[model samples]
Target chain A: MKALALGILAALILLTAPGSQALAAEASEAPGAKPLAVGTAFPDVPLIGPVSPELADSLGIPQNGPTPIAKVKAEALIVEIFSMYCPFCQRDTPTVNELAALIDKRGLAGRVKIIGIGAGNSDTEVDIFRKKFKVPFALFSDATFAVHSAVGQVGTPYYYVLKKTPQGFTIVAAHLGLIHSPADFLADVVAKAGL
Target chain B: MRRIVPLLTLAALLWIAPAMAADPIPGGLAGNIYPVPTLPPTDSQLAVAVGSPMPDFDLPTITGGRVKLSDYLGKKNLVITFVPAAWTPVCSGQWPGYNIARDIFEDNDAALIGITLDNIPTLYAWTRQMGDLWFPVASDFWPHGGLAQKLGILRSDGVSERALFLVDKKGVIRFIDVHDINARPDLGPLLEAMAKVHAEK
Candidate 1:
């Protein structure tokens, strides 16, 4: 009876642990798929747009044609996987914009680049989301869900921080759901990326 | 047993605390959204046609007001969308998407009306999870999908079809998309259609 009670307590703790719901949800949403872990190779998914010249220069990619994420010229890259249809993403727009601004304010803009991919959203749909939210970073359209599939079909507002390596990029940290505080999140990214 | 009771109670408290805390956006990604099974592409035949007058409706909205289809006849173009029911996979994901597209609708001088066969109470509960929507959501419940039936989209299983009807300022249906039941209809064609209708004299 003592052993059974202990087992029940452990299960309850695991179930109610912070972020446990999101983890369980991610597993159910994409069965057999796993979240990209720290020290794992970040997928070199092709991104559709960086329409503006400045954004292109920042990412070290061309204005046209699909560009692989590995080609981005930065010491660290923050990739946000989102969906226009996600209420959470819509609500987190302001905080995400603040995160980009915080990066610039901290003088990490040169070493860190932030970008977003709209999972399953068409180009027009992406544009609408961008305009409505006034997002500062370059956003790519995953109209065909190619990027979404390549990245494990994670839920919206998912964040991945990657550190540039000689061979390619390495996932340093991954977060699911809202960035509670832009300053704190960027600080963590800066610390994780060692920049 | 007495010692174990306190431990179990502490575990329960930890489990309930986070859920009870005020969430800025309730029913968000972490909220109660259910996954549905893949359904047939198209379940019912459309009764309405392009260029025909869409039947006017005065349905109860989730906001506790009646929205008449003819209200925007001369002033604004309209996009009427009918999904099977509320709280399902595609239906839940669809309208929240439109929340961010308020500008698109405003730019084209169009109003979007979302309708489902669920009652107003159910719709009110369901949409609350989607956050505040920019457009009105009306219920077609009392008559049991009366408008859906008039539009010839009520499925044999008693739910409405996943469909879209673009009605111009003159109340003429300009475009119709009886999309596949399981998939989300691409927004490109609808935007193009709205642009076309907005450009018309």
Candidate 2:
């Protein structure tokens, strides 16, 4: 038993030693699967959610089944890929809430709509985040990771800004990590979406 | 002396293997694939039944402190939660869900302490990803599952079972749930248990 304990202690020290951090660094720096770039047409992916009546009305979607990205009447869309369990996402909750408010504060709510896909979270978990944060925006469950894969998501707290065009919606920007500031992030999104 | 060289080389390779294959993120939403355990029956040879006094423990926490079970005896109700491991799927979701439910416990005048067999560094990396878990996450590592073994909830694999013990202000265990290792315990029952503990006192 003492030998086993020693073995585990050795394993712990060996695994967590400062020199071993390179493994984590390498994996984090690994290039993600190619993301959808600017000017590329947005693929028609059905967003699965309870689509609130208000959101449906705003998106020009009927209060019925899933809403498709192509059907949104807004000039621009911000789809935040998040996970309820992500620390960064949890820390950024207030910032995201601020961003949501900024759209209304800037009078961009009608032209720019925002929603979130809870990657790897169940509906119940997403609802927990919504209630805990008092988030005003709709959040959808992506338990099967379909939405994450469709959007080429690399990690949680990712974002994709899409702009509506005469032909179809095109990718405007992709962002990773927390938004440094609500005003600056809003300004960047607004500039990128050309709205 | 010549034969010692190859043995030393083998030991070096063995040491390097785990570090090289370490998960980029210790406990999070991606690149994890451990099969969930089937839900076990409530009664077991490896469980501390309700109505028992919880054994006092002073274990090291991931956040650089030691927590004792007796510390909250008169001040607040205590909920001791044991998860199977840090990086498993169900366990990963369990604490993060609890992170946002601090108000529920506060309302019930209860304090939560999470215990796992994982060492401090492993627990630190795991809970760091979980986001603002207000509770103390104790590591029952030095004696290898010491406290968990005392509670009879330590699995043969050297990890604790997914168990919850609610101890009242008097330090008597009020409710116990040795839940299915694979499933996240419903918060409703826990809240109900806390409410019951408060009503009785």
Candidate 3:
């Protein structure tokens, strides 16, 4: 009789608790919150660049091929997924241009294709910003945002450096920032994929 | 010489006191909502204070027009509000709050602009989708949260964290309220700020 009473008391407490549903919702959400940080072999799903259409129309890139830039290309690719009007990216570009200069100074320019992909905008907007920021690299247009969708990273100026190895192209590092400094950024990138 | 000295001292005191006036810095970032002593002592977290200068911006508007941080710096003051994405619930409630205050903003020679990462097409569709018609909803779409990111208000993932900023015509920020994804900016505080801006200086 005592045990049955305690069980009944427990059931009543659970049923009548204030904000219980919200607590349960939080409990259910915490674990599901994706913590896929650096080194998580970025999903293999095909992604659309912000400017892929312009490239396809202009250069016949991928030539209707499955992967753009390929799952395997260089030692590593420094990809900047951006939208033309992203305010943080505007601030970040000057910083990114500095890093690009350092990479050029280090003779890693072509080897490290510092690329930009436009998210859901016309090719022209991306081009205008590229000129405004003087970011020498061509911005890829992701007409569908498939790439942004696959990575589940939606922030502009979100950067990903993927290194191709005998295994496959895997993400070395990714950051969304007003980066602390250019050297610190390079250090993190170099540490992961080697200078 | 002695009488001249007191007059000089009084003039100096008058000039120095207002600059010493401590602007109330807001606290309660991350979750709690209280006023902190000053602008964040550290930049570790992506938060801005109420009276700090609103981070600057120059971007293309939805209708092929250009918008600058300075153009709308109203003759009196300005309010800049950022919403996470269009078509969300709390934003639905929050944006309309700005709309309802439109008349008061105009009367005081103040202006309000709502900014977000959603493109103009999406912004237009969503506003109409939700039947929001009062204030201008500016798009931060192409550059993808760039303005918010500079302000340290963009989330690590993609969507923006809801925020509202009141900037004076002098380009000095007078009010800032950045909320977590779920929290909403209380319209009462904004109404109070508007009142203060209109109050005779």
Candidate 4:
């Protein structure tokens, strides 16, 4: 009876917490569309760019062409959906860079690749974001919101871990909002992608 | 009873954690942005023209300092932006987007001044969600859109139109974009104009 009372009390505190309530309110306001679920086939997103020589070598794609997501040479891929205007994305820039460094530290640089899609941002906007944050990954513009719509219009700073298979790319994990711990997030990505 | 004490304590921490992390700005994804209805495209007429001397004004900033258009005349080029109001949709997203474009202004040796009809306290509360902005935000509140009225972008609803003015170091307006009241002005063109102005100098 005492344990039951404690559980109920704990549950009550969580339920009534101002932060939780605010989160719930915000969640409701978010689009009802669900993100690409894990175990689902990832779409072949066409990314446009004046792809830098370094990014081309990293993804093993041509420097001047629209590269499809599935065509990128990688055993596993981390897709970060962000917006140049998103404060959370701005705050998470360093952490996401740290995640990339962590990937290199784990010797997963060749096998695991990361890229960012600037939702609803033009090439100029993406360029500004890239330069401002000194982002170390290849970022593509979704100026027309085509990629955003393709990815279900989920909120900014959304992450997707996908594994390449003979069939296609399959979603391994999908996360929304700020990544609290880059190390843990990379660990999860590594484990889920089996890399 | 001892076990219950720790459990309650843990519950209390859980309750306080989110509150501590709560952002003062209300909305979630991109700071405290509230979704507002799409307004009419262009609401007001442009009173000032390109090549005309921009009407000078002394306005109070959110930081409690006063800024005069004349103060920047001989020193730096100016890009003055006027938004309709605070806490609304396009207005909220517009300034934060400029946060990343600081280098563009700096590259051209230009200073950006964001203006809104909202008073200092309201602007302070609304801008807190934008984190650290690279420019000063001024409130044109005393005569309520006095500066806006001088520039002739004040709307019928007692707010200014969403507009931008690129003023050269000579205090002569080089470009004027009385943009649609409902949408954000594109940064690319503004940057291009700033570059052109710098080239002329």
Candidate 5:
């Protein structure tokens, strides 16, 4: 019994120590899968934020208004996928708001547009929420998660920064969570983008 | 030189009697995945201090009113239960569990609220289908997951992870419990936590 216990303990300690499961998980990321890393080329992510958009034209959703993709203007774009009801997205608002404020402060707001792509929500819900949260950034609604599916954003504030390149818009950076204090990160992105 | 080792080293850890006697209930955790600045007035991170001024968001109530967190102040304690999404296993079990706890909150002069990333229509339909009673299920839908993400409980998949909170009459978060995304919360522990809070002066 004692031998069995010590063997199990040793295995556990060794497995949990550095150079174990964590490394395996990192190694397993898909080859083409963008790490939300710096300098990765961001694809031209298509988006449709109209709430509950339908396959048939009779749905009476807006026929115009740039199809929601035009909002990603300027040389650099910070696109965030979000849903109003998501608590994590809501929690990250202050950080997002701070990012917007930083852009405005640095005069990079014009050069780097912040587009909020809201999915899994209704148009009315998105509109009401947009005004409520005081999201100074452009807020678009993706009714059936079309944009979310297109960009393959896993969750809200799945941030992807894109800068205009010769071929098209190339991704500059992608951050997974609300880590870096909002202001500092936004400033760094703007500086990196040279905007 | 030969020395006999004392039995204390083995005995100290071989105390299986206590282990066998301990309840199965889990204890507090190691590193917290979600960290928030400690604020007075609320016990749990899930609940905010009543009357302490709710956070800024124009979330709509299931009932007819548009409310900020401040609107519920001074009237009654708010029970905010945030789950990942509807129709999932743990959440299906969790929502019904809250429905079961309605009586307890009613006795405590509180209101029960459920928030999720599902659209209002989906929330309404799910609530009705699940046979939930007087509880209100709010949709944080448009922002997709504005609330849970802000609460630091949003999972990588854009859904709100399971989290529960009890806000007292003063709008202070009284009971907060966040669990592993896959795990269902313990109703018994939640009840005990609420009871302890209610018993407080």
Candidate 6:
């Protein structure tokens, strides 16, 4: 009798558990949540790690695998959400490379850093993109979409500039589509980032 | 009271679980359904067949100017990709996937030509959002799916099948794929097909 009663209890829990219910609530809430806009403090979102080798080499940062966003040692950071299969991302490659070049040319490399999160792409796909475009910045794959969820990303080729402040970081700017001109993009970033 | 409360909470969880599965992605398109079409279009009279010479047509392009199939025959290979329509889920992302694979087509000395029943303006606007497609996008819109109908892949829905036909240097149909309208064909098969045709030369 006790065994039968225990089996019934287990079945009830599997069929109607609060833990699973809570997870579903969270999933529903994610899509409806207010997006982080400019001037809003950047949330302490967790980052997927083992940063790409090329990016680590470019930034001269030692690869201390699986680092957090808070641990990134930079005055300001530009986060680009992209995907390998996204044609817009492919088309936007040269412009992004230009931004990286401008940062280096203007000597902003020491203060400003750019990193890309490949939304819904695998590491191999991200590697293909990095190689194809010869990207000079760090790019990470967020195949599980954790990073995308953190940023509330709607599509690829999204941009967000985060300025480091004493109290962590604040989003300085956000753009939805292509940055038509590299010079203008740099100027806007410099002005908004207050660098 | 506490024992009864557990049962009540369980009932609530059961009531809400299924509804929660359809949560929307924030700032994303709503009512986005990707039901894979089960019934493949019945095999109709196909226009071009294997070992047959592809018929030439000067169809209007999305980026202006017309594309003539015979023009590329002597100089380069050609791959014509025909998707069903605009704004559909799979169709929206399909061409963009090809946009990134420009090198694959270039290496094989082939040019990709995307076609659809939609008019030039529709293709222009839709492809513009797809970002700088390196290939020419054509419209088989004039005769209301005339080109696709000639190829015999046009479905009864007045749209082309998600098809691909690889024509070699002699303008011969070397490979063809009348892919499932509901599915995105893998790129590997296309690449392999390109290699096979390249070897024949």
Angstrom error of the Cα, residue A184, model 2: value is: 4.4
On the 0 to 100 scale, the lDDT of residue B120 in model 6 is: 92
Provide the TM-score for each candidate, comma-separated: 0.85, 0.64, 0.40, 0.83, 0.42, 0.55
Q: Which DockQ value does candidate 3 get?
A: 0.01
Candidate 1 C-alpha lDDT tens digits along A1-195: 665567567767765666544422321133234578898999899889646888888888998749888889999999999888877788788999998988888888899999999888888888888988888889999988878888877877789999999988899999887787998898888899998
What C-alpha RMSD does candidate 1 show over the true interface residues after superposing them?
9.5
Clashes of each: 1, 0, 26, 0, 43, 1
What C-alpha lDDT, on a 0 to 100 scale, does residue A98 get in candidate 1?
A: 91
Model 1 CAPRI rating: acceptable
Candidate 6 segments whose C-alpha is farther than 4 A from its true place: A1-34, A37-52, A59-75, A83-95, A106-111, A118-134, A140-150, A163-173, A178-195, B1-75, B86-103, B120-134, B146-156, B163-201
Give the alpha carbon lDDT tens digit for every residue of B109-169 in model 6.
8888999999999888777756577899999998898888778988887888888899999
State residue B27's C-alpha deviation in candidate 6, in Å: 20
iRMS of each prediction: 9.5, 8.2, 28.5, 7.6, 14.3, 11.5
Ten-residue segment with the worst summed lDDT in candidate 1 chain A? A23-32
Task: Give the per-prediction TM-score of chain B.
Answer: 0.85, 0.80, 0.70, 0.86, 0.66, 0.79
What local lDDT score does residue A8 receive in model 4, on the 0 to 100 scale?
66
Mark the regions of model 1 whose C-alpha exceeds 4 Å error after superposition. A1-33, B1-30
What order do candidates take by DockQ, descending? 1, 4, 2, 6, 3, 5
Please report how far candidate 4 places residue B55 from its true position, in Å.
1.8
**DockQ metric, candidate 4:** 0.19
Q: Which parts of model 3 have CA positions greater than 4 angstroms off? A: A1-35, A45-66, B1-201
- The reply for model 5, stretches above 4 Å from the true place, is A1-41, A47-71, B1-201
For model 1, residues B1-201, the per-residue Cα lDDT tens digits are: 767775776677667656654444343434455666777777677788998998989999988898897799998999998988886777777888888788888999999999999999989988886778889999999789899989999988888889999998889999999988887788889999999889878
Q: Give one digit per residue, the lDDT tens place, for model 3 in B1-201.
A: 645554555556545534433224211111111222222212224646665776788766555676687786656587888877765544544553344345667876787788888888877765653334466668877678878877787766566767777788877777777765664545556756767877746
Best by TM-score: 1
How far off is residue B62 in model 6, in Å? 5.6
Q: Which ranges in model 2 have alpha carbons more than 4 Å from their true place?
A: A1-56, A60-71, A143-146, A165-170, A191-194, B1-58, B62-77, B84-97, B120-133, B150-153, B161-201
